[model samples]
Target: MQIRTNALVSSVKNFLIEVGGIIDFTVLVFKQFFKKPREHKEMIKQAYYAGNKTFPLIAITGFIMGLVLTLQSRPVLVEFGAESLLPGMISVSIIREIGPVITALLCAGKIGSGYGAEIGSMRVTEQIDAMEVSGINPVSYIVASRIMATTIMVPILVLLADAIAIYGSYVAVNMYSDVNFQLFYNQAYNTLSFKDLIPATFKTIIFGFMIGLIGSYKGYYSKRGTEAVGAAANSAVVTSSLAIFVIDLVVVQVTELF
Candidate 1:
């Protein structure tokens, strides 16, 4: 019994240490975030990779999500003979909850892992040290670029995904009962207020920042081993993914109070 208790306490201690370190790392990044960002061209390149490169994946996923959701929900709504409400219902769901969370999680997997591995490899190889020797800020150049890229791009991607998902729903709705394009769009937007849109978009920006920050933190402080590179990447995905759901819960709770 004592042994088990000690193990549990040890686990909690390690977890808290990790949380404290991440908080400090985030603060450092924020300090750099406000300054005139370095590597203007690098930020653009990172943005392209994080945002533009992600379009195809998001587009296809959004379409499938909309179509599948509509098809699945239609049968249930139809049971009540309320199939007409499909557009508004789906739009509400995709916009208010589904869209942002899905997009952020996808980014957590793809972008987060990439950041960790790239940064971790640099850390293990002494590249980050070399930058410091040259009087360069590795944290700002690499970490800030990624955090800002993801911070800026993820929201844009979420917007695009939300619109594309609505389009997919339109296609699905038409397959069952014809809906005029304008009417379908109008109904979709009608159910959405500033309350839904603003909070959802805002949370996604935070989500993006968290993903990039966590990934960068793991990589930036990685241990000096080749194996640490892969560990960083894996931990990036797991940690950022968990962070998404946690932030999502808080956002939802805060939105409810509004």
Candidate 2:
């Protein structure tokens, strides 16, 4: 009984610590964001690296996601003889759930890990200290830029992913059925209301913020030596992925209630 009680207490304590870390990291990023804008050039570079360079990977992943989803859903839909609903169903699922979730996960793997490693390395190498000694606010320059870049870029990438996914769905539809481009899109857009689009889009911003926050927090506070960099990167991805699901559950529940 005592052992079980201790395990429960430990679990609760760890949960609280993680929650506190998330809140503190969010506050710090926002504070730095409004404090003063610094490192515009570096921010832009990071944006390109995080956004533009990631386009191909995002596109391919989205394409495969759509293709696989459509192919897999076909038999189920056909069983109901509701094959015509494929476009609408795929669009709704992609836009409302799969697209944002998948895109965020991918971004967490790419941008989150990158931010963790970059900042972890900087911290380890004393580069962050050098910037401070030079009168540069590392928080504003490093943390703020990464936060902004992720917040902005994830949505754009999601939008693009949705588009590509639709195209992939089109191909998948044509595989065993007949669906013209116009007719497919018409069915898709018809079933998708503003309610679905708005909530899904907004939730992605939260996803972006979480990814950036966790990544930056882990990287910024990393200790040890070179090994810590890898650990930071790994932890950032794991924590941010978990955060994504937690936030997604909350957003979905709230959206449903409203």
User: For candidate 2, lDDT tens digit of each residue in 111-202?
Assistant: 99988998999999999999999998888889888888888889889989999998899999999977789999999999999998999999
Model 1: per-residue Cα lDDT over 188-235, one tens digit each: 988888998999999999999998999999899889899999999999
Candidate number achieving the greatest TM-score relative to the actual structure: 1
Native-structure RMSD, model 1: 1.1
Clashes of each: 0, 0
**C-alpha lDDT of residue 109 in model 2:** 97
Cα RMSD (angstroms) for every candidate in the order listed = 1.1, 1.7
Clash pairs, model 1 backbone: none
- Candidate 1 achieves a global lDDT of 0.92
Q: Model 1 misses residue 248 by how many Å?
A: 0.6
Using all chains and alpha carbons, the TM-scores for the candidates as numbered come to 0.97, 0.94
